[model samples]
Target: MQRYFVAPAQISGHTAVLEGDDARHLAQVMRARPGDKFIVCDGSGREALAKVVTVDKDIVRAEIVEERFAESEMAWRVTVAQSLPKGDKLETVIQKGTEAGAAVFLPFLSQRTVVQYDERKEAKRVERWRRIAKEAAEQSHRGVVPEVMAVSSWKSLIGRFAEYDLVLLCYEEEGRAGNGLRRVLTEFAAKQAEGGKPRILIVVGPEGGFDEREAEAAAAAGAKPIGLGKRILRTETAALYALACIAYASGELGGD
Candidate 1:
């Protein structure tokens, strides 16, 4: 069934009103009408089975049938702190990362980052990224859409380290040294099993990867420098690799 995410206010007393693009998609693209069944999420992790009652040009009203328990989300909340790569690579990361259960996408500037930051266009860019995340979340059957954060500087990114239970810095140097990601994730999994949900931050550098000084600074700030593997991965690939490993370790991938 198709899924639509709406604001909390859009749902009231067993009724859901999908407006804007979602409404158009349902009415025109899906050719939805009265009695059409679909899933509705409130963007706060709450989802319900809803049956369409009305379809208009810019609105689609539905009655909530029953609340649904979404097991699609990962038990561990993983945030991808990706350095801004050149071109449209960040879009790919946000789209695929959301499907893979990433909770948030944070783009930051690193020492070797080549893309120039344009304050004038930042809002538009961020908005586009968020849209990509929402669409991907809906398609992936996620109860909540992943947030796409505004770009931050390297210093700003490191300062937020305390916000996460575990911060994995994807450094190629560590990969060459044989410090693998699996061991760190295993430790994190054990901690999660003890009690309480833990938040993880996976930091990947720009196309050039992180400079030695940046890696050292991150490690000093409590971020664990871990390697994806012996083979080097592009900056965009690192976060996805780490997220997959995390999902597997947290049993989201059917692991014990």
Candidate 2:
């Protein structure tokens, strides 16, 4: 069935309303009619199996036949704190990361970041990223769309580490004091098994990689420096790689 996310307030009692753009898409684009069934997600993990009851120029109303619990979400939440890469690379990170079970996205600037901040364009860029995440979530059948926060600084990254149950830095310096991602994740899974609602933050560096100071600060903030593998990866690739691996480790990718 087709799925559309509706605002929580739009759903009251057994009726769901799709307004504005969504309504136009249903009425004009999809040519939806009464009695057609579609899935409606509240974007907070609850969904309704609804049958269209009314379709007008400005709105589409559906009656809920059944309510659903969102089981597609991973057992734990994963957040990607990706350093702003050049061009549209950040959008790629948000899109694929959402599909791979990321709960949130954090775009930050590190010492090695190449993209300079533009206050005038920040809101627009963030909005684009969020739209990408929402579309990706729909495509991937995710329970909720991952949120993309506005650009932040290195200090903000450090200050937010304490908010997560496990924090990892995707670094390629194999010779440095570090553990492989597999080992680190395994240990965390075993040791922190009882940690309710696990929140993990995986930070990835930009194309030039993390400067010495950024790496040092990450370690001091209690983020384990972990390697993806021997080969170097682009910043966007690393973010998706980390999230995909976490999903498997937590049994979301496959049955244990």
Candidate 3:
């Protein structure tokens, strides 16, 4: 079934009214008609099995047939704090990161970042990335669209690191023995086995990667510097790889 996201205000009782771009997509693009059924998520983790009641130019109305909690969200909350890379690599990061079950995407500017974004450009870039996330969420059958935060500096990100229960920093300088990501995941999994939710923050650097001072600063802020593996990957690749590893480690993927 086709999935659409609607705002909470538009949903009242067992009826939902979709407006703006979504309405256009349903009425004109998809040519949806009355009696057709689709899934509608309220972005608050509630999904309704809706049957189209009316299809108008400016509004699309659907009656909820059934409502249930969205199962597409991961049990663990994972946020990716990625330093801006050159070219359009950030778009790929946004798409794959959402599929890998990231709860939020944070784009940061690090010291070694070659691409620069001023205030105006930063706003536009963030909007574009957020759209990428939304499309990815829909494609991946996600319950809620992952949030893409406004671009920030590395300094500011580190300062806010205290909010997460676990923060993993993929630094190339770190070797496999003490700082490998797999080892960290193993240890983290062993630490707990029950109801409490895990909140994680994964940090990935730019194309040029981070300098020594920045790495040290992140370490001081309680982020564990972990190695991705023997082979080095691009900035965008690294973030996606880390997110995949996280999902697997968190048991989001099936296991015996």
Best by TM-score: 1
Clashes of 2: 0
**What clash count goes with each model?**
0, 0, 0
What is the overall TM-score of model 3 with all chains considered together? 0.96
lDDT of 2 at 212: 77
Whole-model Cα lDDT per candidate? 0.91, 0.87, 0.87
Query: How far is each candidate from the true structure, as Cα RMSD in Å?
Result: 1.0, 1.6, 1.4
Question: Where is model 2 poorest over a 10-residue stretch in terms of lDDT?
Answer: 171-180
For candidate 2, the TM-score is 0.95
lDDT, model 1: 0.91
TM-score of each: 0.97, 0.95, 0.96
Model 1 C-alpha lDDT per residue in residues 1-256, reported as the tens digit of each score: 9998899999898899999899999999999989999999988888999999999999999999999767788888999999999999999999999999999999998999999899999999999999999999999999899999999989999999999999999988898999999998887777665546799999999988899999999999999999899898987788888888988898777746
